[model samples]
Target: MLRFVSFTLAIVAMCNGQIAVERDPVCGTRNGFYGIEGNCDAYVECRDYRSREMQCPDGLHFDPAVAWPNYPCGYPMEVDCAGRGIAQPAQPSAECPHLYGFFPSPKATADECGYYRMCVDGVAVEMACPPGLAFNPSNARCDWPDTVSTCNAAAFLGFTCPPPPVNEIGELIEGPVNYKYEGNCFAFFSCEEGRARLLSCDAGYGFDPISGRCVDGDIIKC
Candidate 1:
């Protein structure tokens, strides 16, 4: 019986490793993307084995999860890019507010988050929160540092700037680096100058800084 149990465990381990490798999405792994014919708006880059930048039409966001054989950039957001196309500058960032005609979130409550995606000159960009502050999603608005008094941090854009650590003498610690946390895999710490600050991952994910992938902490070995 013990021998059988050990064999089962080994099989499970092998399956886990296989799934991890096969599920690991690569930037250019999708053949459907390459097959996308004609000229298109090249967007985010997948700097891996595919060895090239990815592209989609002007309004679509590059969702790596939806790679190859689908839309070049996966899915598309409902932005009025067709109505107001912002001329692409020489360089572009994926989180482009200007990609679509920016308008106030029609569904926003009176007490809205500070940096909600809004139309700036017909572009949708998330405006910055106050200097010493960050956006809090619980209230769907910006709040004081003390406003978030519990672990309900998943719904906010946390401020990453932290004061230097006083415990250690002023020895330069290499940083401005991001690290995954055992507590919450989706959230990560952006550490710089000895201070590590938390930044929330995208909705429905914990971050794995080692792989630079958003993952669920509940499953990762940490």
Candidate 2:
């Protein structure tokens, strides 16, 4: 698991840096994406390489070292650098499902069969599949999906695989209020008062009116 010492430290390290040089497939936007791209919520400004402008919405200097490259999937596997061999960040453990992660497309074709392909920055990398599973490009398996809701495949080594659309969310820096005590943190999530059946909470923390809670693996935030 990737652990940050403090939320303030995390903010100092992550927010308001340039978006990964690559483009975000969803909105076809580069330099940033959604609410995160260059928001400066963490009190920093990321310089847009194209515009060369330095602006931090939250009022902090951009830290080049902490910038998370913008990728299509929330947690993309590949790292993109302009003519640079940027090492990829490690995938987060399953205990915390919201961190960035990686996955493969499908097995390659017969000609390319036996080839294992991992999706990096939404692009497929051709390589030999690990022992056991034969490459089946048609299936497009991102890591092996452990569909059993109760199971934590990512937590166990060698038995699980990365979930597709490698999604990510910031870690829980604060505790919750208003909700009554629940057995665990994951269970506290339930639908808001008047909302439809959306998602349930894990235990200690219910959904954030702002960052939305995880409901059936779908992220529904305010």
Candidate 3:
């Protein structure tokens, strides 16, 4: 767990070896933001020889590359906290792994791939992806389950994509293809990169395997 301390207080606390803060060219020599030693989420603001410690918001880190007065902080993924390795301790909740970010739902099941949790200032809010899509934690967005490792596309949709067609030489044909999802008139399987992704037709429409497209639901037999 990381701790934040003002520049002055840090010097005093260093003796205990509990928290190590950077001590360098004193602040107030220049009007700008300076990175705190060993702390990625904290910086010192200098104005007219006056200094005040500042901290980036939750889930963000100080970006020395950014200039002053323009908000020199950014998301941890975007900022490179190389030497300055320390960060604020995570404030986790039952539904939130961090104070601000998207996380997989704790209650998600094999069939419930669309559920996710959004954390804002330590508060957790449950969210769900639209039908035919699954919550992807890698990129923090809703995507096809086949492309998301955590969600097994075949198990979730109870369908598997068949092997791709091959030519006379037995070379795998590479292209997009669709297949009907058995027992579900509204859904189908879209195959890409040898993975099966479950897709759905719009309201009042059903998948037509013969035509390989969605058609009017009234004319399609379930």
Candidate 4:
């Protein structure tokens, strides 16, 4: 359960004389899939107003550092700087689902399986359900063993051998997930002792997918 202190500091335009950055509502065009990357209602932009030529290296994405200098905005996983300048495959690189917190791909959509990834801080880590448990996408949380309508044993034997989930709107949960509650704070629903349990976010907080934490509801992805 990662949380952030209340965001009271205004988003001032901090400029280093060479690069000034701020979070903007303008969408970022990364990986082929578009709409909005992760829960980021705004993208970080560092530019030289005179020419807008400033940019982060190819391997790195812009980070607003809203949390502080500790959490640099970008991919949670390490980037191979050496791979820069190489012709990338036409397809988008495999990446964590920035939309849902910072979930990596292959589990972003959250299928019949009972496991997915949760972005704690800026790193994407795998979360599993309890023993004899699998997540029911239709219910939006963990459920009894073999309860999901799409649990394909042949397709998955190790992913959910025993465990967790992701969150979405009215769509199925697929796994344990943390989501915004009624346009307010964050609430994560999971299975405790074979029953569903909903955990509310701390006061004055909401789930922000871009940063992958419970922050002020000023920007709600849900």
Best by lDDT: 3
User: How many clashing residue pairs appear in each of the predictions shown?
Assistant: 10, 22, 0, 13
Taking all chains together, each candidate's TM-score versus the true structure is 0.24, 0.18, 0.59, 0.23
Candidate 4 lDDT over residue span 97-195, tens digit each? 232232322452324365756544334567766533565545435565345566653243222222333346554346343332233347643343233
**lDDT for every model?**
0.46, 0.32, 0.79, 0.40
Candidate ranking (lDDT, best to worst) = 3, 1, 4, 2
Worst 10 residues of 4 by lDDT: 27-36
Candidate ranking under TM-score, highest first, comes to 3, 1, 4, 2
Candidate 4 accuracy as TM-score: 0.23
- Mind giving the per-residue lDDT tens digits that candidate 1 earns over 127-200? 65553234544543445433534322333334344454343777655546666655565666666654445557
Off by over 4 Å in 2: 1-116, 119-123, 132-222
Indicate the residue-level lDDT of 118 in model 2: 48
lDDT for residue 137 in candidate 3, whole number 0-100: 80
What lDDT score goes with residue 141 in model 2?
Answer: 35
lDDT, residue 6, candidate 4: 22
Question: Per-residue error at 92 for model 4, in Å?
Answer: 9.5
